[model samples]
Target: MESARDKRTGEIVDAEQLWIINPVDPMGYECRGCSAQATPCSYRPENKVRPYFSAKDGHNAGCDVEGEVALVKRARKQRVTIREGFPGSFPNRLVLRDTRPVSSPDGSPTAPSSDGGRRTGSNGSSERCRNRHWAAQTIRPICRTFINYPFDRDLPLVVPGVTADTYQHVFRSLKSDQVIQYPEPRLFYAPISWKASIADDDRLEIQLSYGEWKERKLTRPYRVRMDWTDWSAAKRNYVSREIETARSEYMTAKKRGDKEKGWLFFIGRQDESDSTLFHVDDHRLVCCVVNEVIYP
Candidate 1:
């Protein structure tokens, strides 16, 4: 169990709180399950083990800990599947507004056209919502076929059990189509530069470059939190090592005045907590170093 109720205070006690309670000594907390005595348990941080409460009696009948079951359910909800012959076989009709770059009176950033509505041809026009408002001075709407991608709230776009060849095919198809853009409003993805330290939210900070975002400048860096439990043990190890190596290489390249910049590709639901910032929680699906992705 990751949490247990305090026998004395009647409050829920987490593993970190109990860590300071001196596990070797008697602490006034016990497992909420079965009323058995509980102890705080954790492995070294490098071991990447999630902390949990352990009963003195070991495994008990019907412990109700949810642990792995909860994780599986969470991952299942966020899973994304791009079927074989995805875009080619299944085409989507999207209405894109012609955006003209116009400076504000005070030379502020340009505003994009409000009409970037999308619809599905296979399911008919009513399958998705359309943006209603638009300006009079706009170009004729250009209709294009786009691949429909599934995205989950607060979760990254993960393609489970997908081969690299399939991913490459999808990426190449999206790249070839000039009209296809990243998901908007509820979803977004971009190339970013990472900061060494985490932000106040205890998440990593990443910066999006200019001209990437249409509505906002994204001048400030966004925060991201990686949920390692969503990933398989082997993938977690690989991603960690690759990140370190990529960061080192990026720093070295910068010092040498090379134009090469290490970019991380991230796709996830934007954070509603801040108006100007975005958050990434799905590291397995939509997160990767640009070089690693392009080369691999």
Candidate 2:
């Protein structure tokens, strides 16, 4: 599905927006088509199937982004193929792959032979995502520096498993006359453990343990706050939840007589502040990951 409204929050979420917060609580969302409850069917980062939503019941007759429409669109694009291209100026880049359907284990296409290539099986959701799609993948690159514009050329330092497309899509979505450049710093997943603290100024800072931060080559132990307006309600809520969860885990571990430093992950953007301070911003361009997860 292209987009759906959140049943709980009444927010409109699209496929591009869903990628950041994969494995979300399925019950919180519903299909925009029929207003039926929706379940997110996202592929693993390594999988080719583009993440999508499926109606818990079935698609309605008037669904715009599903069924035949989706099939026709997928069939027309057929495949995304990227060839070796010139390397650009920006050394580091985030790589995003075009979403494709997962192939069958038998190495055959999964599009149903019945119904004249029309998708089948449970509202045809599975069929739509899987059938008649080519296996070829394309890698689109986005610059990692804190520049106002995305790099027109590709680079060697590509961040693996980070599905970020060229900034063109994001820029188009923002529809802004000017945008800040976003810096691509290190990205850490859940296993690293993240800790967050709120200062009196309402600045949200996240950090690792002092020793760990030093070992990781972090010049500063803490991340400064981005402008509050840069955050989406969804992103703010998720950050709050993650912070609370981290605190809860810390207390639980302490009660168990285990001493451990909580894990800390970076949020918002990392911009060039004063030479002494590590600067970060919360604008959509700077915090691309958070923007997708939080915004519609």
Candidate 3:
């Protein structure tokens, strides 16, 4: 899901989505949210059933940019190039994490960009960020995406496994590199040593979001806590409370039959460090956050 960023707050997840030209599967698509011709290949041709960009109500009718279409004949083949391309340009970019350093498995060096893809900053250090303390996350995912909940799609489940090899194994088995990109950042899951009370049985709830919650008009930052301790009644209660506030809104909409709006499953983590540094790998279970509204 695309997020809006608060520039003043040191770059919150600004939900701006860009239409990425799939190096492979250029012709294989369904629109990415609304029809923007600049990202004509983002969605399939069938999405433009009505033949207009969007109606006043905002239901997309077709691609927004036309005539100067630059979509490739195939997307997956050159998908990596698009990411590692020119360095200064691309159709669209969604920033997932700004200046965050994630440790490598051996904790030796900074980890490379999540997938095998590479990027080159002007200084050239971005080419292999595994050594650097920060990574610039730009995601070009499907217009209609389900990062976690509806795992039915071939979408990579970033939060469900362990081992450094897990990422490569999952990405390699997938049919499309375009699949490498998604509607949202791949679900990053990690194991947490919390006890059974909060996550008794396999049933658990977690909240996934990019920025800090705030009062109306961005009054103040809302505090988020993660329950990684052994399952205690108090822990369960706290988890339940977190669910009610963040996940419940989307759950209610989805379960109560609001199809237009979908939810993104995010592994919840207690950021003892800061709001942006979500230690998802050590997380217990999953949670949902109904992100911003999107056009189909």
Candidate 4:
């Protein structure tokens, strides 16, 4: 599972955030749907795969997680329009909290609430719950949804500091042909180039696949320069590791004949002087996502 409920803190945490914990509690996680015991996997730095949670034994009868996955898959196969609304639940807003309460060791184990895995409308009806939207703690889930539901890009979204309302308007793709000035900030995404990137103490610059090419060689590609000047060593490493892991996964899939591409997503502003460059500071606002084709 991509997310699980923390028994100690009564909070739903994304699996990617496990690295921030000094020592993860083995018995502190439970399924967000069935409240079954969950085990964290591939969370260590040595693990190349992305971190996720799995049931310790098996999920209980009528686990919503499986149903939710099925619903998403079914929705992906359909042609969705903005007037009809999204067929499944999705995160509509990005909520970036400055600080979170620390989990107490002596705290009582908290079970997942009735509405933990799903959201209900004001009427509290099952039909209304189908199109519910939740707030996301990180941009990773938002990026996943963006890639999964390409047909529903017109769905409503709320990203702080961004003026755009729909997913299609909020996410801007960097053009490879020419550099253009962006007056408004946006959530930018670009395909990662296989070329070598620049990493230094002050910042890390990553080359995008889209750029000016000369005889099949990338001449002037747009780049994202992450300023880790105020970030700790661990934080910097986390960001770098995520990008590497995504690239590795994409390559592995490609070798197996899967058409996949590693894409970088970040909420940043384009440089005024250099239109080919973007500036990102916070690690939380940036993530690497591998786009995969979902077969019905």
lDDT of each: 0.37, 0.38, 0.28, 0.75
Q: Positional deviation of 258 in candidate 2, in angstroms?
A: 6.3
lDDT for model 1, on a 0 to 1 scale? 0.37
Q: After superposition, how far is residue 111 of candidate 4 from its true place, in Å?
A: 16
Q: Can you tell me which runs of candidate 3 are displaced by over 4 Å?
A: 1-144, 147-152, 155-227, 230-242, 250-281, 290-296
Q: Judged by lDDT relative to the true structure, which candidate is superior, 3 or 4? A: 4
Per-candidate TM equals 0.30, 0.33, 0.25, 0.83
Specify the poorest-scoring 10-residue window by lDDT in model 2. Answer: 132-141
lDDT per residue (tens digit) for residues 181-266 in model 1: 33442223333455563433234454444222434533444443454445555444444543554566667777887755555444
Q: Which ten residues in a row have the lowest lDDT in candidate 3?
A: 172-181
Candidate number that wins on TM-score, 1 or 4:
4
Q: In candidate 1, which residue pairs get closer than 3 Å at backbone N, Cα or C atoms, i.e. clash? A: none
Task: After the best TM-score superposition of candidate 1, give how far the Cα of residue 40 lies from its true spot, in angstroms.
Answer: 39
lDDT of 4 by residue, 185-281 (tens): 8888888876666889999888888767788877778899999999988878878888888878777777888778888989887888887888898
TM-score of 2: 0.33
Q: Which number leads on TM-score?
A: 4
Q: Model 4 Cα RMSD, Å? A: 4.8
lDDT of 3 by residue, 8-122 (tens): 1212121221111123222122222232211122133233211112122332443221211332212212231333332111122223442444544543225433322235779
Q: How accurate is candidate 4 locally (lDDT)?
A: 0.75
Clashes of 1: 0
Model 2 lDDT tens row, 1-296: 53454553333454434545645677766654345677776523453344567775787675543554543334333321236442111224332333333445653235422112323568545332222211111111121121212232222333443344333332212111212233443332111124445633344544332322333463433334544455656556444444554566665666777644234333233346532223334322222221101111
